[model samples]
Structures are given as C-alpha cells and as structure tokens.
Target: MEEIALHILDLVQNCVEAGASEVSIAITECRRDNLLTVKISDNGRGMDQATLAAVTDPFFTTRSTRKVGLGIPLLKAAAEQCNGSFTIESSEGKGTQVVASFALDHIDRAPLGSMADTLAAVFAVHHVDVHYRHEVDGKVFMLDSKEIRQLCGDELMHPRVIVWLRAYIEEHEKQVGGEQ
Candidate 1:
C-alpha cells in the first residue's frame, strides 16, 4: 500500500472477514514525542495463538484468493523502517488489536493522508457499525455510526451526513494541527 490509509483499509477488511460487527480505529500523532501511532481494534472472531504467530509472515494468509498476505507484514515493515514498533494481539472468539508506531519525522513514514475521509468512506460503505475516535494532542473527535443511524433513521447514509462528517473531521484536524 502506498499510504497508511490503504493499510487501514486492508486491516478493516480483515476485521470484516472475522465477522466483526463493530470496529474502532484510533490514531495518535505526537510531534513532541516524535511519534505517529495507529491502533485498530475489532470485535471480531480473532485468531488463535498459531494464526497470530504467523500473521506477520508475508507467506501466511487466511485468504485463498492470494498466496501472499502482506497486510500485517507490510504494516510492520513500515513501522520498522521509521525506527518504530508494531504489535498484534488477539484471542480466538474474542477480538484483535493491531498497534503500530512510526517515527514522526522519518522520511519513510507514510503520510497520514486524509484520515477523516478514510473514516467517512468506511462508514458510508459498510453496513457494519463502527466507533471511530481520532485524537491529536489533547483534542478529540468521535464518530459512532450506530448513533448516527439511530438519529437519522434511513438517512444515516444520506449525502448530508457524509458531508457533515467530512467537514467535521477537517475542522477538527485543523484545530489540532493549528492551520499548518
């Protein structure tokens, strides 16, 4: 994947495949600490110890459609290239959490990309529920699809909702980044 957004998409796909009804994605960028951290958690059918152990192997994948599974491996590599760390934890019938950290200023650290759009895209496309919280420094912006669905009825996917989300995220990003 050329961007971290793609990696996030891949990981979310995995969560869906695991039968997750809800997923949570959190991103933290701390310039003072010189770190960018991405964490994804899903209430899905998580892997056992054996599968977890091999998830980082490029040669291992549960999908029969492809011989190489590089989602986890690639994310790990991206973090490592930036002098950071990647960790995956899961349990059968429970859930999984993938946390990756990268050096904030590393030339190799992929751009954060339009994370607000990424979250909105996922929510708009998937019927599954999700709770997304994005925090930069001490400020926080949260989106809960289920809540939106309750308030908007069938209009959760309405164009206005998407537009609102996109704009809300953009505004929050600006607030956190300070008009950079």
Candidate 2:
C-alpha cells in the first residue's frame, strides 16, 4: 500500500474476516525516537502457532477465495524497508495483535493518508466496535465506537450519525497532527 492507512484498513479487514467483535488500533509517532508505530489488536478467532508461523509468507493464507495472502507480508516489508520491525502475537482462541514500526524520518516511510475517511468507512460498515487512538509526541486523540453507539442508541447507523462520525474523526485527526 502507498499509504499506511491503507495497510491499516487491510489489517482491520482481516480481523473482521476472522470474526472479531472488537478491534483496537493505536498509532504512535515519536519524533524524538524517530519512530512511527502502529499496533492493531482484535478479539477474533486467532491462529495457532503453525498458522502464525506461516502468516508472514506471501504465499500462505487461511482464505479459500484467493491463492495468495499479501497483506501481512507487504506490511512487514514496508516496515523493514524503513529500517523498522514487525511482530505478531496470537493464540488459537484468544485474539491477535500486530505491531509494525517504521523509522519516522526514513526516506521510504509511507505517509498516513486519509485516516478520517478510513475510520469513517470502517465504522460505517462494520458491526464490530473499534477504539482508535493516535498519539503524536505526547498528545493523544481517541475515538471509541462503543461510546458513539451508546450515545446514538438505535440511530447509530443513521445518515446524520455517520456524517457526525466523519466530522468528529477529522477534527481529532487535525488535533493530533494526522490530518490528511
């Protein structure tokens, strides 16, 4: 993916496909450390050691719809190309967590594109609850879909609510210096 947000979208979709009811995405940009880290955790049907071991292989996938899986492998390569690292932890029935870090100032580091749109798109369609947090330096912006659902009640999927969500996410992204 050309943008880190696209990578995030892909990973989150994977979590949804795995039957996740909740997902948490955290992005931390530490200029002092020259690091941009993304961590995604999902309460989904996770993998066993054997599956987890093969997740990084571009040719391996749990899906029958496609012959190859490139999401995880591509993300790993993106991080490594920027002189950073990627790691995943999972258990058969528990959940999964994926972490990818990139050197913030690396020449090859991808931009974080259209995050507000990404969040809005995911939130609008998926039934899963999501908690998104973005931290730049020490400032943080957080958005929790659970809270929104509670506030909106049965109107959670109303058109106005979706618009509100997009606007809210955009404001937060701007506050955290992640506006695209």
Candidate 3:
C-alpha cells in the first residue's frame, strides 16, 4: 500500500475475517524519536504457531482464494525499507497483535492518508467495533466506534453521522499535526 492508512485498512479486514468483534488501532508518531509506530490488536481467533510463523511468507496463506498473501509481508517490507521493524504475536483461541514501526523522516516512509474516511467506511460496512487512537508528538485524538454508536443510537451509519465523524477526525488531526 502507498499509504499507511491503506495498510491499516487491510489489517483491519484481516481482523474481521478472523472473526474479531473488537479491534484497536493505535498510531504513535514521535518526531523526537524519529519513529512512526502502528499497533493493531484484535480479539479474534488467532493463529497457531505454524500459521503465525508463516504469516510473513507471501506464499503462505490460510485463504484458498489465491496462492499469495501479501498483506503482512508487504507491511514488513515497507517498514524495513524505512529502516524500521515489524512484529506479530498470536495464539490460537487468544488474540493477535501486529506492530510496525518506521523511521519518521525516511523518504520511503508512507504518509498516513484519509484515516478518518477509512475508519468511517469500515464502521459503516462492518459489524465490528474499533477504537482508534492516534498520537503525534504529545497530542492525542481518539475515536471509539462504541462511543459513537451509543451517542448516535441506531443511526450510526447515517450520512450526517459520517460527515460529523470525518469532520471530527479532521479537526483532531489538525490539532495534533495539521492535516495528516
């Protein structure tokens, strides 16, 4: 993926396919440390040791649709290209967590693109709840689908609600780092 947001979307889809009911995405951009870190956790049926080991292999996949599974491998390569690291931990019947970090100022590091719209789209189309926390420098902006659902009731997917969500995310992004 060209953008970090696209990688996030792909990872979240993996979580949903794993039968996750809840997922948490945390992004930390620390300019002082020159690092951009993304961590995604899901309460889903995780992989066993063999599956976990093979997840980073492009030719290994549980899905029968194709012979290649490039999501994790591509993310790992992206991080590595930016002089960063990628790691994943999972246990059968427990959960899964994926962490990818990149050099903040690296030329190869991808930009975070349209995260708010990504979140809104996932929430509108999927039956899962997500907690998105973004931290840049010391500022933080959080969006919890559960909270939004509670506030908006059954109209969580309404057009006005999506508009409000996008606006809210934009405002928060500006407050953190100005136009993410």
- Identify the superior model by lDDT, candidate 2 or candidate 3: 2
Q: Name model 3 segments beyond 4 Å from true.
A: none
Q: Give the least accurate 10-residue stretch of model 1, judged by summed lDDT.
A: 171-180
Q: Which one wins by TM-score: 1 or 2? A: 2
TM-scores for all candidates? 0.90, 0.95, 0.95
lDDT of 2 by residue, 49-130 (tens): 9999999999999889998999999999999999999999998778999999999989998898878878877877888899
Q: lDDT of all the models against the reference?
A: 0.83, 0.90, 0.89
lDDT of 2 at 14: 95
Q: Candidate 3 — which pairs collide?
A: none
- Cα lDDT, model 1, residue 108: 84
Model 1 alpha-carbon drift over 4 Å, by segment: 158-160, 178-180
lDDT of 2: 0.90
TM-score of 3: 0.95
RMSD of 3: 1.3
Error of 1 at 81 (Å): 0.6
For model 1, residues 8-79, the per-residue Cα lDDT tens digits are 877888898899998998878776898888899998999999999999999999889989998899999999
Residue 73's C-alpha lDDT in candidate 3?
97
